[model samples]
Structure formats: C-alpha cells, structure tokens
Target: MIESKRRRRTVANIATYFVLAGLSMFCIGPMIWMLLTSLKYEADIVTQTMQYIPRRVTFDNYVAIWTQSGFPRLIGNSITVTFLTVTICVATGTLAAYAFSRFAFRGRTQLMLGYLVVRMFPAVMMIIPLYVVMRGVGLVDSRFGLALAYTSFLLPLFVWMLKGFFDSAPRELESAARIDGSTRLGAMVRIVMPLARNGLVASSVFIAIAAWNEFLFALMLTTGQGSRTWPVGLQLMVGEFQLPWGVLAAGGILSILPVVVLFAIVQRTMVQGLTAGAIKG
Candidate 1:
C-alpha cells in the first residue's frame, strides 16, 4: 500500500511538471518565433507559408539595422535615460521608503496612498498635461527630461517596494548601530541596507525594466533620434507601405536581450529577496 501511494505521488509530480512545461512553452513560443524569424531571410519572412526556421540565415539584418536606424544613439539614449531614472528613483525612493518604514508622522499613510493614485492614472491620460508642462520647461526632445518623467512615475513604486523590505528588517539592528555611535542614516546605510540587498536588487531590476521599455512618455517627449529609445526605433522601422518583418523581428530580439540577460543573472537574488521578505512579513 505504501509503495502504491509513492508511485501515485510520483505520477502526480510528473503530470504537474508536464503541465508547467507546456505552459512555459506556450508563453515563450512567440518570443522563440521572433528570434527564429530574425534569423530568417527576407524571402522566408514574406513567404505565405509559415516558416518556423530559416532556409538561409543571415547576419545582414542585424548589421544593416544597427547603423541605419541610429540604433547606437538610441541604445545610448536608452541606457542613459534608464540608468538616470534608476538612480533618481533608487536614491529618492530609498530615503522616502526608509522614512516611511522607520518613522511616524501624521498623514504619512495618506500620502503613501496618494502616490499610488498617481500611478493609477493611466500614463496616456497624463500625456497631454505632461507634454504641455515639458514644453513650458523646455524639456521636450531631451533625454534628461525623459529620465525625469520616468523617475516621477517609477519612484512611488520603488518606494513602496523598498519599504516592504525595510519593514521586514529588524529595528533593533538600527538601534544597536545607533548605540554604537552610528547615526540613524549610517545605521540604515551600513547595517539595514546590507540585509535588504535582495529587495534593493529586485527593485532596481524593476525600475530598469520599466524605464527601458517605457514608450508612450518617450514618444511624446522625444521627437528626434537624439533622444529616441529602442521601442521608438523599432516602431519607426515600419514604413508607410512596406514593413520589413525580418528586420523588425531582429530588432525585437536585440531589444529584449539586455533585460533578459540581466533578469537571468539576478533572478536568484530577486527570488530570495522576495521570499525572505514574505517570510519576515
């Protein structure tokens, strides 16, 4: 009877794995198809027949698009805007989150909720006002301006996320550090932060992803390639009457590579951070 039960459990586990594997394939299938399409020849892409793989693969698409579309400038612009946004969000969010987690002030909770309301407003709704404001400030078509916009939208999220981790941390650590002559800020920076690295890393990843992929704000704010991002560059690849599917596919794959690599590299830390925070909470 025990052996029979164990065999049944094994079969159940196998079925679960099968289901999970199938789901994963379903989700990843489109991304896989894009990569395959990128490697295909133009003829393969334009063909009526569904071709999963290329008859003749070429590196020419990647090479041609890189310079033709001002991709290097776009990449630089994206990296700059993303990192700047992350920096502003992390620096400002960490302090605010630490304040919210560690201190008490009247209306603090209400203010925190207010920040969420800002995010609740669809970004598209904010575009017209944001455009007018940006125009007034002479920030249109500027990368720094775009970075500031992203930081505003992303900061509240970062603050709330970091606050969770901070809340999960022990207050005694800060108290002990203070008794040992460390300032409150020092305690937070030196002791509490090290313990909260997992959360910080995860939050940073989120900020990077959001900033990198943001399109609407970028589109409204940036008119020239001087400040255009990969998403915009990818969009412009489509012409009035002719769309180059192979080039578009190649661009999509290239665009996602950095975020994918970063996620893969730090996924373990993010998981640990989230799980540890959950347990503590």
Candidate 2:
C-alpha cells in the first residue's frame, strides 16, 4: 500500500511539472517571437516562408522608432499617466481601505459592494460618461485627464485588494500605539502601514501595470501625440497601405522595459507581499 501511494505521488508531481512547463511556454512564446521579429530586418520578417530564426540582426528598427517616430513622446506620456494613476490610487486607496478595515459605520457594507459594482461594469460603459464629464470640465485630450479616467476604474480595485491586506494587519498593535499616545493616523503611519507595506507594494504594482497597458480609454481620451500613450501610438503606426511590423515589434519591446525594470526592482517585495496576503487574508 505504501509503495503504491509513493508511485502515485511521483506520477502526480511529474504531471504537474509538465503542465506548468507547457503553460509557461504558452505565455512566453509570443514575447519571444516579438523579440526575435524586432531584431530581424523588414525583408527578413516579410518572407515567403516561416522564419523562426532571423537571417540577420540589426538595431535599425529600434533606432528608427526612437529617432524617426513619435514613440518616445508616447512612452513619456505612458510613464506620466502611469505615475499619476498609481500615485493617486495608492494615496487615496490606502486611506479608504484602512477606513473600511478599521471603522464600522452605516452603509459600510453597501459602500464596499458599490465599489465591486463599479468594477463589474464593462470599461466601455464608462467611456461616454467620462468623456462628457471630462469635456465639460475642459479636461479632455490631456494626460492628466487620462490618468483621472484610469483612476475611476482602478481605485475601486485598489481599495478592495488593499482592504484585504489591511484586514490582515493586527488591530492590537494599533491599540498599543494609541496607548503610547500616538494619534490614529500616527498609529497607522508608524505601525499598521509598516506591517502592511508589502501589501501596499503589491497593490501599487497591480495598479501601475493596469495604467501602463490601458488602451481603449487612452485612445478615446487623447487625440494628439502629446497625450497619447504607447499602446495607442503603436496602433496608429498601422497605416492604410503599409504595416511596419518590425518597428511595431521594436516599439512593443521598448514599451515593456519600464515594466520589466519595475518588476526587477520590486520582484522580491511584491512576491512576499502577494504570498503574505494570500496566507493572511
């Protein structure tokens, strides 16, 4: 019986590893193809036969996108919008989440549920109302306006995710800080926030990624190159008569660098926070 169980466990482990490997390949295959395509010349890419490997590698695509196209401006706009979105979401979401986690008030449950309702609505549904409001307020066609649009959708998500993390933080610590003459906000800043710092990082990264890759709102909100983001700018690269695949691929690669660097810097912290939240919340 023991021997049979051991054999079964080994087989299960092998199957799990195979499944994981296959999924990893599925997710990473497109990225690898894009990177390879970016390195190839236009002639090599637009070939008669399937060319998995590049005949020649060149940095010309990168140079052209950077120097010739408005891609740099788009990248700058994406960065600016992402910064603003993450900053606003984190600042407000943290406080709102802490309130939900600590305080009991009338309609608290209903309010939290309302946030979930906001998230449930399709993003497209909000566009008309947002456009009308933005136009009325003279915020249309601006990066800050785009950032505000992102905040409308992402703030609820940030609050919900962060409330879970805040819930995991011990109330006893805050109470102890209060006894030590710390104000409520001081207790949160000095004690609860430190404890939940990892959770905060995880939530901020999530919001930042959403803001970076968001396209529809960016496309709808901004008309000019001055405010358009990378995704929209890349889409506009496809002309009526021609498709610049190599340039687009190069742009895609360049566009991902900021996110990649962000992940590299915060990988350990984000991982710890996510794992801790999973276990604790």
Candidate 3:
C-alpha cells in the first residue's frame, strides 16, 4: 500500500511538471518569436511563410528604430509621465490610505466606496470630457497633462489597494511609538510607513506600470514627438506603403525592458506585502 501511494505521488509530480512546462512554453513562445523576428531582415519577415529562425542576426532593426524614429523622445516622455504619475499616486495614496485605515470619521465608508466606484469607471468614458477640459486649460498636447490624467485614473486604485494593506498592519506598532512620545504624524512616517514598505512598493510598481502602458490618453492628448509615449510612437512605425515588423518588435522589446527590470527588483517585496495583507486580513 505504501509503494502504491508513493507511485501515485510520483505520477502527480510528473503530471505537474508537464503542465508547468507546457504553460511556460505557451507564455514564452511569443516573446521568443518576437526576438527572432526583430533580428531578421524585412525581406525575411514579409515572406509568405514565417521564418522561425533568421539566417542573419542583426541589431540593425534596433539601431534603425532608435536613430530613424523619434523613439528616444517617446521613451523620455513615457519615463517622465510614469515617474511623475507614480510619485504623485504613491504620496497621495499612502496618506489617504493611512487616514482611512487608522482614523474614524463620518462618511469614511461612503468615501472609500466612492473611491472604489471611481476606480471602476472606465477610462474610455472620460476621454471626451477630459480632452475638452485639457483643451480649455491649454494642456492638450503636453506631458504634464497626460501625467495628471494618469494620476487621476490611478490614484483611486492605489488608495483602495494600499488601504487594504494598511488595514492589515498592526496598530500596536503605531501605538507604541506614540506612547514613546512620537507625534501621530511622526509615528506614521517613522514607524507605520517603514512597516508598510512592501505595500508601498507594490502600489508604486502598479502605478508605474499603468502609467507606462497608458495608450488612449497619451495618443489623444499628446501630439508630435514632444509628448508622444513609446506606445504611440510604436504605432506610428507602420507607414502607408510598408510596415517595419522588425523595428516594431525591437521597440516592443525595448518598451517592456524597464517593466521587466522593475518587477525583477521589487517582485519579492510585492509578493511579501500581498501575502501578508491576505493572511492578516
């Protein structure tokens, strides 16, 4: 009976490995294809049949996209907008979340519900009104305008998510600090903030990723290279006569690099925060 049970366990392990391997292949197949296509020449890419492997690997597509297109400017704009949006969301959301989590006040539940509802509102519905307001304010074709719009859209989410994390935090830590002569604000900053570092990092990562990938607003609100983000710039690569698949793929690869790097850096903190919040809550 023990031998039979062991065999069953070994079979389950093998099945699990096979399933995981298949899922990994499915996820990575497109990325591998993109890399290979990016290295291939236009002639090879445009042929009737696709080439899984390129005869000649070259950085020419990357170079062309960088030098010929205004990719550098687009990258800069994306970075600027994402950075500002993340900073604003993190700052405002952290304070707002702490207030909601720690303090008791009238209409607090209503206010939190309001934030969640606003977050649920679709961005497409707000585009027309936002465009008009941006136009009225002379911010139609500006990075500042795009960043502000992204922050507004992202802040509600950050507030809701961070509030959950802050709610799960132990109140005793803050109370101890206060008992030791720390002011309320000082206790929050020095003690609570440090304890909630994982949540803060997770929220920041989400906001940054959102801001970086924002397309509709960036495309509509911004014009020309001055405020165009990478997503918009990448769309412009397809010309009337021909589409540059290699360049587009290279640009896509470049665009995702920062997000990949960021996740690699903060993945541990994000996982820890999310797990802690789940367990505590």
Candidate 4:
C-alpha cells in the first residue's frame, strides 16, 4: 500500500510539473516572440511566410524608435512618476499599515474597510473628479500629477498588503522593545520592520509596476511628451496608414526591461513575502 501510494504521488508530481511548464511557456511565449521580432529587420517582420526566426538581426528598429520618436521622454516620465508613486505609497502606507496592525483605536475596523471600499470601485469612476481636482490645483499635464493619480488607487492596496505582513510579526517583540525605552515608532522601525522587510519590498514592487503600466490615468492626467508614460507613447506610435511592427516590438521589449530587472533584484524576497504566512514556525 505504501509503495502504491508513493507511485501515485510521483505520477501526480510529474503531471503537475508538465502543466506548470506548459503554462510558463504560454505566458512567456509572446515575450520571446516580441524579443525576436524586435531583433529582426523591417523587411523580415511583414513577410509572406511566418518568420519565426530572423534571418538577420539588426538594431535599426531600436535606433529609429529611440531617436525618431519621443520615446526617451516617455521612458523618463514613466520612471519619474513610478518612482514618486512608489515613494509616496511606501512612506504613507507603511505608517497606516503599522497603525492598523498594532493599535486598538476607535473605528479602526471601519477605517480599514473604507480603504477596501476605495479599491472596490472601478478606477474609471474617479477620473472626472480627479481631473477636476488636479486641474484646480494646477497639476494636470504634470508627472507629479500623474503620480498622485496613481496613488489615489494604489495606496489602499499597499496599506492592506503591508498590514498583513505586519500582522505576521509578533506583538511580543514590539512590547519588549517598548519596555526597553523604545517608542512606538522606534519599536516598529527597529523590531517589526526588519522582520517584514520582504513584505515591504513586495508591496512597493506591486504598486511600482502598477504605476509604470497604468494607461488610463496616464492618458487622462497628462497631455504632452513631458509627462506621458511609455504605454501612451507606444500607443501613439501606431499610425493610421503605418504599422511599424519592428519598432513597436522594440519599444515593448524596452518598456519591460525595468520591470524585469526589478523582479530579478527582489525575486527571492518577494517569494518569501508571499509565502510568509503559509508556514508559521
């Protein structure tokens, strides 16, 4: 019976691995194709036959997109706005999360629920109100304005995520720190935060990616090349009479590099953060 059960488990594991591999390929297939297409010449892209592999690789498409268009400006704006959004979320969300995790204040439950309520509404519903507020404050068509717009929606998510991580950290340690002459903020900074660093990184990366790829807010908030993000810029590159597949592919590849690099840097931490609560010691 033991041998039979082991054999069945082995077979199930093999099937699971195969399914995971297929799904990974399905998700990553388009990215691989895009990278190959970006490396191809314009002539090789719109071929009579489906050219899976490029006969010749060229950097002309990358050059054309970088030099001919306002893509660089768009990239710069995206970086700036994404940075600002992540900074604001981290700065504010961390404190709010800590408060919710540690305190027994009045209406705490209601306040946390309100944060969820903000996220429950479709983002589209807030566009008009946001536009009016941003315009009134002379912030429309600016990178900072766009970042603020992203924060309006992403902050609640950041707080909720970090709050879960904080909950995992023991309150005993915090109380011990307070007894040792540490203030509430000091206890959090010294005791709770280090334990939850992975969670903070994961939360920041989530909002950063959201801000980086956000198109609707970027479109509605900004007007000129100075503040427009890469998504909007890439969309604008598509002309009525012209479809520069190679250029678009190159732009797509370039746009994802930052996110890929970010994941590579924090991948281990993110994995730990995600699985932190699954197995408690």
User: Which candidate's TM-score is highest?
Assistant: 2
Q: What is the TM-score of each predicted model, taking all chains together? A: 0.91, 0.92, 0.90, 0.91
Quick one: best lDDT, which candidate? 4
RMSD in angstroms between candidate 4 and the native structure over all alpha carbons: 3.2
What is the per-residue lDDT of model 1 for residues 1-281, given as tens digits with 9 covering 90 to 100? 99999999999999999999999999999999988988887887877777777788897788777867687788889999999999998888999999999999999999899989999999999999999999999999999999999988899999999999999888887888999999999999998888888889889999999999999999889999889988887888789999988788888888899899879856888666433452336
Residue-wise lDDT of candidate 3 within 1-281, one digit each (tens)? 99999999999999999999999999998988888889998888988886789988899999998998899999999999998898888878889999999999999999988977877767889899999999999988888889899987899889888888787768887888899999988998988787778878888898899899989999899987888999988997779998889999999899999999888867777666433452336
Better of 3 and 4 by lDDT: 4
- Can you write out model 4's per-residue Cα lDDT over 205-263, one digit (the tens) per residue? 99998899999988888998889999999998899999999999999999999999888
**Full candidate order by lDDT, most accurate first:** 4, 2, 1, 3
Clashing pairs in 1: none
Error of 1 at 149 (Å): 1.0
Separate clash counts for every candidate: 0, 0, 0, 0
Poorly placed runs, candidate 3 (over 4 Å): 1-15, 271-281
Q: Residues 155-205, candidate 2, lDDT per residue (tens digit)? A: 999999899988988788789999999999999999888888888888898
TM-score of 1: 0.91
262: Cα error in model 3, Å: 0.4
Give lDDT: candidate 2, residue 91: 85
